[model samples]
Target: MLATPPDFDVLIVGAGISGIGMAAHLEMMCPNRSYGIVERRADIGGTWDLFKYPGIRSDSDMHTLGFVFEPWKHEKSIADGPAILDYLNRIADERGIRDHIRFGHKVVLADFRPDEARWHVTVELEDGERKLLTANFLYLGSGYYDYDDPYDAGFDFSEFEGQVIHPQFWPEDLDYTGKKVVVVGSGATAVTIVPSMAEKAAHVTMLQRTPTWMFSRPARDAIANFLRKILPEKVAYAITRFKNIRMQDFTFKTARDKPQKVKDALHKRISKTMGNDFDLKDFTPPYNPWEQRLCLVPDDDLFESIKAKKASVVTGHIDKFEAGGVRLKSGELLEANIIVTATGLSLAIAGKIDLRMAGEPVKFDERFYYKGVMFSNLPNLAVVFGYLNASWTLRADINSEFVCRVLNQMEANGSDLATPVLTPEAEAQLEEDDLFDFSSGYIQRGKHIMPKSATAYPWRLNQEYLYDRKVMRKGDILDGVLTFTKAGANAQSPDEQLEAAE
Candidate 1:
């Protein structure tokens, strides 16, 4: 039996940070409009709520990760996962966004009916039932990570007798205490898991295919904390934010200009910290700094654990999984009771949405990206992407603001639909190689799905706050290939008219 169809002004998929932010903005912009956010999980916080692995934390500072309207009150800039999740949950509850979210409701497919000018959304309920919804607009706030499966690198684990766990699918009942744990992969998650598990486990071994460029920074900024005690909260946050931004900017510039110098400096730092115990060459990646990603070690804890003989790093290729352990290509078998695969996430663009326009299929591969906001030839759809250089929320904030402006403009112009259309020549000018060179699955999947821009600043993901403010906030919202379709002409209903006006 088909469940009762609920009609809404807007239907938002994924009740994560982006979805919550979008809901809040939509509510503020059009208070009378009826909207609903659907999430597959029982609660909010998306990835934060999903992952329960030890030592999970934000890669970026708390200030950057947090929403602009709500400042993070925590003293530590680099916060752990539980704290971040709490902050998100608090935001959802405080803003009354929890009511708008329909948990355990996963959107299966969304089809736009041009004649009706509404999106026919199909969702699966928790009770093995299917429900249909119709909305004038559809907004996807699902982040880039693949939530369906934990990243296991094509390893035939059938031969291995040890228990295997992916951090994404971490079991609540499983205990790692006194067990020899082997964490496979070289990334932020692996780096974090090794040190944290070493505290409880008998031994922790971090096996990596290649050494990641690792850098050490204190989890709690002592100077910032001192300043906070003396200065106002806002002032302290500003100072720390500026300091972090400038440091990141300098590092990015150095890596781009003098790659060898950055590598040499990093090599020296790692050697100085580890002395004879750590193998510097084995841990250093051959690629340029930031080519993959620089692993941030909190307070040299990973190294400290290695020095104490509780943890160790092994750099080699895994031949296969043996009965009791991993067999490396170098003919060495490392025994372990448990194996953790921190390989990486499989990227799904717009969370694998099937898009159609005017009853014709729209291939994302043939399309072009407009300022990273709108895809060419797409109508009334905008994808929110964050800055690669700065905090994810910084860019997300601007995107939200820009979306508000566009919405306001549409209302004022009495338009029912707006589509950004790019020229064929302009679209062809984009270079694929320079766009997303990252070897990760997310970047690889985005090659056809995401916008391909060569430059970083202004055109691409320039992390500069001032530049983004000017281009995204101050720039004209309807300047480019935006085609505005007036109401009634596109067969929009009276209800949609009332909703749009609201």
Candidate 2:
């Protein structure tokens, strides 16, 4: 029998924003390297397409959230779900990138063969057929949320006669117009729906156990609009992108450094906006800002809705679900015709794919991450997970460019494998904690299975975007931290080969 060639040089496990961006970057920098995107969903947009809840939009503005290579031409900085999906589709279609995507391929197994320096991937198609693909490198651009299972919040939905809806699987014909609505949770999803539903619903109430940090900004970027009219399109985008990034970074840094000052400033804004009638305590979060992702309200829509008497906020524990509505622990009942559980997402790591090396199973929990991208001692793979504190695409963009640099470096050095080996000293100094460092329910719920971050650089989950950009931009492939092994190095064991990466 004739020998067969590997499917592609690089296998990207998602066709979402990061995957598409990865494809674009690969084509731009390493044209000779062949790659294909395998997406489980039939469509292009990942989360944007997956979610159909009313009032769904981005918490982060489009200037920094948009891809570095592409300019978001839309007027709204906080665009709706459909607009974002459309933007993603437009990039894929216009760039002719859709041709390389293999839809309906769900990766179930990814095993690294150290002997051949390749990955043997097992994919399951929608039609129930299983197939195998081989590649020199694997890139996980698949977003982290679990599609099949959203967080349940442990509510007895059977007791409630009212309509209970999860944001991920919003019903097509469930009309909430002229109905009393209560949105559960105080995160981005709940806030987004509270304002949008307030426009149609008779009255909407946001129910939360604790308050969340909220910030308001105009939906449209005045400077960006003015710049577009005067400056070149790309130039305007660059300026706007830089300005937003710097401002966002400053706010986050200030919060971390002088939390009490930031807290006071936030109280001032809330007090000024809501006036004396509204209780400011209901808006004040207990924890310091940036401990969890802050909620963004565009153009003060949520506040305006509250001011117009279209919506209200209720902070209490749910005693139980009654036939009429949710009963609070204080013996008060809030009547609601529709209950929206904007609860939270169920976070899963590595897409539940059983990753192995040389037939030996790999346990992610036992290892610390390498530069927040590659797993410790895992060879030839990188997972792109962005910062919760910043626009996800910021890290994704830098990650794609970083991958391209690694591939080019490998080709130049005639190397076939690159792995992040935990040195004896690094291992001794390793500190095991939650990878996210977040207090959100989703992060708390999934911390056990998540990987750990070390106490030092090239191992810690660097949450700061500007710092990460500078670090990853250096493209130090042989920084003595990440290891690379040569092709057909049979004389050495896998452990020895990994240490010989440089």
Candidate 3:
């Protein structure tokens, strides 16, 4: 049965950071317009609220990960899960965004009608009832990962008698205390889970398919703390943000330019910290640094766990699962009371929502990205993607500003819809192979969904903060691909014409 539909000017899917941020921008720009945010979970904070794995925290620094309009005031630069969730909840409550969010409402499908210039969205309520809503604009912020379970390759777990758990679907009641635990995968989740579980488990073994580059640093920023006491809070935040951004920029540049030196330095640091307790080959990555994400070790916790003989890392492929254990391809068997498959997530384009325009299917795989925002020849649509080299919020902020500029211009020019039309030559130049090279699951699934770029920065990815600000925020919005349609001569206003020229 279908329930009555709700009408709104804008309907945003997912109440995560991105969705919430988008709603905030809309409210600020068009206060008179009615807007609603839909979330599947009973609460907000999307991933943060769902993921309850031990040692769950942000992989990046909190200062950069946070929203630009709302600065994270916590003293810890690298915040844990609870702190991050608290920050997100605070932002929603303080901004009065909680009321606008309809929790337990999960959008299943969305279709765009070109004639109406609106999206018909169907959502499934908690009570197993379906409903439809129409909105002028549709924003997807569901993110790339599958929240239900870790997308492990088909391994029959039914045969294994031991308890099996995926970090994405962690059970709160199950106790791991005094139990031999095995955590699989080499990504951030595996790195976090092993150390935390080591504290309670009888023994924790990290089984990885490949080694990843890992670096350890202090989580607390002592200098920033001192500055907070000496200077104003805003000034202190600015100083900390600048220092972290510059340092990250320098580190990424140096690693990219002088690969061998950085790799050697990293190898030496890890070897020195571990001594003769563990083999160096098992911990070192085969590729150069920054080829994949470098794992951050807060306060040397992972290394300390290794030194304490509480954790051990094994590098090999899994053959199959045996009763009460995991069998490695190397003919070695690891017995465990519990298995934690921290494998990885599955990625989906536009949150895997089906998109249509003018009764024709808009294949994301066949489209070329324009400035990493809109697909070629796509109308009334834009995607918010962040920089690979810099903070995700840095690019998202610019994207929001760009959206606002486009909307303001369209209203002033009497334009009913604006679309990006790429030339044939431009479309032909795009290569599919360049789109995905990383080992991460999100990048793999995104290969067919995102734009392929040749270089890392300024072209494929512009990480320079100032450069992006000038090009994306203040640059000509109507320059190349954008095409606007006038509603009617009498419908056009003076403000519309002036905005079009600007």
Alpha-carbon lDDT, every model: 0.75, 0.87, 0.74
Give candidate 1 regions above 4 Å deviation.
Answer: 1-6, 27-34, 276-278, 425-433, 445-466, 487-502
Candidate 1, clashing residue pairs? none
Point to the candidate with the largest lDDT. 2
Summarize candidate 2's per-residue lDDT along 136-208 as a digit string, tens digits: 9999998887888999888987788889999999997988989999999999999999989999999999999
Please tell me which predicted candidate would have the highest TM-score against the true structure. Answer: 2
Q: Quick one: ranking by TM-score, best first?
A: 2, 3, 1
The TM-scores of all predictions, comma-separated, are: 0.89, 0.96, 0.89
| Ranking of all predicted structures according to lDDT, beginning with the best and ending with the worst | 2, 1, 3
Give the CA lDDT, 0 to 100, for residue 423 in model 2: 63
How well does candidate 1 match the true structure in TM-score terms?
A: 0.89
Model 2 Cα shift for residue 183 (angstroms):
1.0
Write one digit per residue (lDDT tens) for candidate 3, span 1-502. 0133238757878887777787777767766557789899998888888899999988888777877677778888788889988988898888888899998988877777644556778889999999988876666677666675447667788778899998998898989999988898888898899999999888899998889888877788888888889998878777777788788888877988998888887777777777755577876887888777788788878888888888888899988999979999999998889999887777666766667775576787666665565666666676666666666666666666676677777777756456666566765664443654455555665566655453422224344566777777767887745767532223343235335534
For candidate 1, write residues 188-241 as lDDT tens digits.
899989999999999999998888888887788887788788998878777776
Measured over all alpha carbons after superposition, the RMSD of each candidate to the real structure, in angstroms, is 4.3, 2.2, 4.3
